[model samples]
Target: MTRRTWPLRAWTLVALAGVLLLSACGEGRQSVLNPSGRDALLLYDLARVMFVGALVLWLLVGGLFVYVTRINPREMSRRLAEGLIVGGGVLFPVVLLGGLLVYSLPLMQAPREADEGLRVHITAEQWWWRVEYELPDGGRVTSANELRLPVGARTGLVLNAHRVIHAFWVPALGGKADMIPGRETYLSLLPEAAGTYRGQCAEFCGASHALMAFETVAMAPADFEAWLAAEAQDAAAPQGEDATRGAQVFAREGCGGCHTVRGTQAVGQVGPDLTHVGSRLSLGAGILGVEAPDFASWIAHTETLKPEVAMPSYDHLPPDDLTALAAYLGGLE
Candidate 1:
């Protein structure tokens, strides 16, 4: 090869290798390869088998190339060529794929979650998830941007979208399902460990589709029960001077028109329920911290941070009112 061309090719290979190495370096629990649940493990195993089978096929082709070019460069008999074509090419692929189909299809089925367990209904909006827990008692608690599941239990999920289609996927837990408009899709994830995992909208819905994400927290059974009980309760009253003023600002600005806070008159269904917003892991559909400052920035820069969102930017609010509003919302826990 020419020297100049060789250097360019070498650089390309180096870049590819760098990317491959970097992709393996992840600390987050959002990888199917590092599965945290049963269905995810099944998927991982099936993928491994498929990958290994494909690798063997490729290696066989490479060996054929070496045999024909280097070991013995001679024309084969027509009879031998036809036999290779029929046996190795046609029959081999049929058997391989048929075996794979037989083995892998059953691994894809989700087991029954439970005879009596909590059910989660998730509705996908343009760029956020509206999460609701259907209690065994028939009452439902509304939440957003975060999902909590009890470890060692299969929790059933009913997913749908508001206006457009979206896909729900938690890589470390299980496969994805499409969330269609006016149609419900079902999935069940049984987490084996108590840890935090990340989930995202896998389908391209609109402008901020890539930014649509949520946190999944697999908790111990007792802790999950307590948290669910707390979630069903009304939001705690805002405390402190700033928080009280913030509540007033929230009312004055008519923020309740799109959001909801259970204990107050701020009941609106257009946006997420803010009854316990402060207790959430993140804000703005899991894109920002739940801290007071994060809330302040979101109130001021909604359009800037998330384009085409339903919530209008409240950048016109005065600085004091904004701060107070942030304080009040942050104290909703």
Candidate 2:
């Protein structure tokens, strides 16, 4: 092929490869492309259209550049050149961008009405999320790390920051909203399907910002109601001797000063609530699975897993005691 043709071909191939790579990147549970909510789907559609339009514009500009540089300039007319400059450079962008704005502005306002939706409050901390659900009767349920929504229902999230600025983003559910300290912001999500999605802190906050993630579970309306009811209740008593011993160990080690477990003396609010810890899909802000070994590791060497976390390491505890503690936390469901 000629050199001129080669450049176009190479550019095309690179653009195609980039698009494919981006498409592959969206297969994760937290992908905007794999949208599960009304707002997210709308945003995805807008993005795809904008991307295609941009690609076409890029090719047109590139082709014009190649034609001008590689061909005889004397063969071009002044009228054609001026038309290309004005139409392509000015009119095209104006029309395209103006149309896009008009199309997307309505979508930005299309989330379900918040007054009729389930109200949830999300407080962003340095590396974790504090979640609270407000019932229709004005009662509230508190949870940490995991957000559960009912499928086919509109949920309103009130965002606030306890320590630093953060952004609450569940890519599959909807667009992100910022969490500013002393300021309450809002976002609305309407889950259209029943499945599990992942969410994360879209804004950097601290040393473990990348690890500040959570799980979003969308369930049937009835199931969600039952789950909410269960969450509202205090944690059940430990059933086994190991768990009982572990609870004793937790209390003796001053773990209560940081974490909270309902129906127990551990009511400190310095860390995530552990009321239904065993039922959560992940632990330590989605860093690890809810397993005994992982729990033990987190307790023993928190700094090793998440550097500069507020929780101190419990590595000095006896091995058996650590095991018991892990077992106890694991059974918190």
Candidate 3:
């Protein structure tokens, strides 16, 4: 009735549960532990080393406490106490941390852009991204809230912020880079596999900072080239009577003043390039889906969905007109 201890199997089950919980946290595209690139792999390796060292230190100190309190219940000799305090407390951590610092210095070096390789210029807006690809042939193609890259290639990203400072981070790909106004920073990622990942603005900039995210898609080189070619084209004409009516609404409502649809006289550059918004994987900078309902919701609830957003709500429009407008935007693909 004095004390109780868990059975070995019970302890084992608890440990297993803890491991499963930790693994679940690292299972998604936004996790650094689920590394798909060279730089992320380096970071994962460093994390493993540090975790193991901390575990070992905890075990050593706990073991010494258990021995002194439960087993012997006696004071240690002066020499043993001094040695334990000096060696285990001082020498071990210094050597381990010094080695870690030496190992991480090279990994922290500035990214180098290889001549003739891929280069992308990214500008961080209040709650979105402006992505421009500098093609090898000296042409520029623009997109928004989505980044595409080729597998097994080192892509150089030139980054800057529009107003406040933001941080560009794709945890599965690499570390964070600060985006300062009027100053260009750089980050390089060498993707080792073809997959979709999530990137976010790591620094706190404004009210919608947490909602500011994007998608990173890594594809085969051929597929990436084909996609780029398609993205370079202007938007297709709106189809059907409802879509046509919606296009008229788009014009009459003066949506063209802020957005550029790239083909039919909607060339304004104050906001994201919606040249192919209908075909994008997501909307509202990865916060909404690409379906018609999603489009309507974003248009109708701009501030409610994304606080302090620059785009005004179009809720005043009639429901039929809204549906038509959504359909027209969807057909831009």
lDDT of 1: 0.88
Tell me which of candidates 1 and 2 scores higher on TM-score.
2
- Name the runs in model 2 displaced over 4 angstroms: 1-4, 75-80
Q: What is the lDDT of residue 254 in candidate 3?
A: 93
Off by over 4 Å in 1: 1-27, 111-115
Model 3, 1-333: lDDT tens digits are: 211233334546977998998877856899997999888888888788778877777667766655666555787899998998888788877887788789777766634444357999999998999999998788889899999999988889999999899999999988989999999988888888899999999999999999999999999999999999999999888889989999999999999999998877888888899889898889999999889999899999999999999999999999999999999998877
- Best first by TM-score, ranked: 2, 1, 3
Q: Which digits, one per residue and each the tens of the lDDT, describe model 2 over residues 1-333?
A: 986578777887997998898776856789887899998999999898888878777878877777777754456688998998999899988887788788878888866346577899999987888999998898878899999999997888988998789998999999988999999998889999899999999998888999999999999999999999999889878878889999999999999898889999999999999989999999999999999998999999898898888898999999999999999999988
Task: Report lDDT (Cα) of residue 57, candidate 2.
Answer: 78
Candidate 2 to truth, TM:
0.93
- TM-score per model over all chains: 0.92, 0.93, 0.88
Model 3 segments more than 4 A misplaced: 1-26, 110-116
Q: In model 1, what are the clashing residue pairs, if there are any? A: 246-324
The lDDT for every candidate, in the order shown, is 0.88, 0.89, 0.88
Give the Å shift of residue 50 in candidate 1.
Answer: 1.1
